[model samples]
Target: MANKFIIRWITLCIVLVVASIKPIEADSDRFNACFESCNEKCKNDDYGNAYCEVKCDFDCGAKEVSAKFNIAI
Candidate 1:
């Protein structure tokens, strides 16, 4: 439990740093859709907050790429 707590905080710090450097367009509809969808799925699947956050970021990023290049992700 202690180890997980430490790891979770570490991951959160790293994410925060990256986010600060290249912030997500939180107001965009597509991003909101992707993030909310991912977060809901993760939550329904009983994922931890750290896992959900990372998964959502990845899913939203993929969506952005697909939309940008018109490629099927």
Candidate 2:
């Protein structure tokens, strides 16, 4: 009984660790995609509505990337 309980506890800890890591990985991927897309848009058009859209996308992506890595900027 004690051995079974110990095994369960270890399994739970491993699962928690993995769950936490998964989100960081996913957020990083999202940030990278957003950044790349925003850069492309900005490069294609550098003024007016296109500029605003690109800036917003870049800011949001940077925020997500910083948050995911616990970076301050």
Candidate 3:
């Protein structure tokens, strides 16, 4: 019984780890896209570097949170 319990616990941990990994990749892709657009605007002096950073974080966080919660952004 103890061995079975240990196997189940390990299985749960592996599943959780795999599930969490997918979101990291998705978030990375979102950030990359945001960076590209922000870089272009920053190059033109549309906003300061700080503003770009804030926008990138806000945009990426909003997207990830909405997707994770199944809420429409």
Candidate 4:
């Protein structure tokens, strides 16, 4: 019984992790796009939008990278 419980717990954990992976990948892609957009704004010398976008993109990209790293570790 104990072994069965452990097996079930492990199975559930794996299922949850697998289910979540797609969304995390999607978020990472989105943040990457945001970073690109921010870069474009900076290149265009749109300082006002660039300033805001850079900060937002940085925060978003950081979170995505952190989450992806944590999963890898």
What C-alpha lDDT, on a 0 to 100 scale, does residue 62 get in candidate 1?
81
lDDT of 3 by residue, 1-73 (tens): 9999999999999999988785334567766787777667765876787787877778777877788779998
Q: How close is every model to the real structure, measured as TM-score?
A: 0.57, 0.37, 0.48, 0.34
Q: How accurate is candidate 4 locally (lDDT)?
A: 0.72
- For all candidates in order, the CA lDDT equals 0.86, 0.74, 0.77, 0.72
Sorted by TM-score, highest first, which candidate order results?
Answer: 1, 3, 2, 4
What is the Å distance of residue 18 in model 2 from its true position? 17
Residues 2-68, model 1: lDDT tens digits: 9999999999999989888954344478888889888999999999989999989988988787777
Best by TM-score: 1
Which ten residues in a row are the worst by lDDT in model 3? 22-31
Better structure of 2 and 4 per TM-score: 2
Per-residue error for 51 in candidate 1, Å, reads 0.4
Candidate 3: regions farther than 4 A off: 1-26, 42-45
Clashes of each: 0, 0, 0, 0
Candidate 2 minimal-lDDT segment of 10 residues: 22-31
- lDDT string for model 2 (44-67, tens) is 675566675668576966788687
Q: CA RMSD for every model? A: 14.4, 8.4, 5.2, 9.6
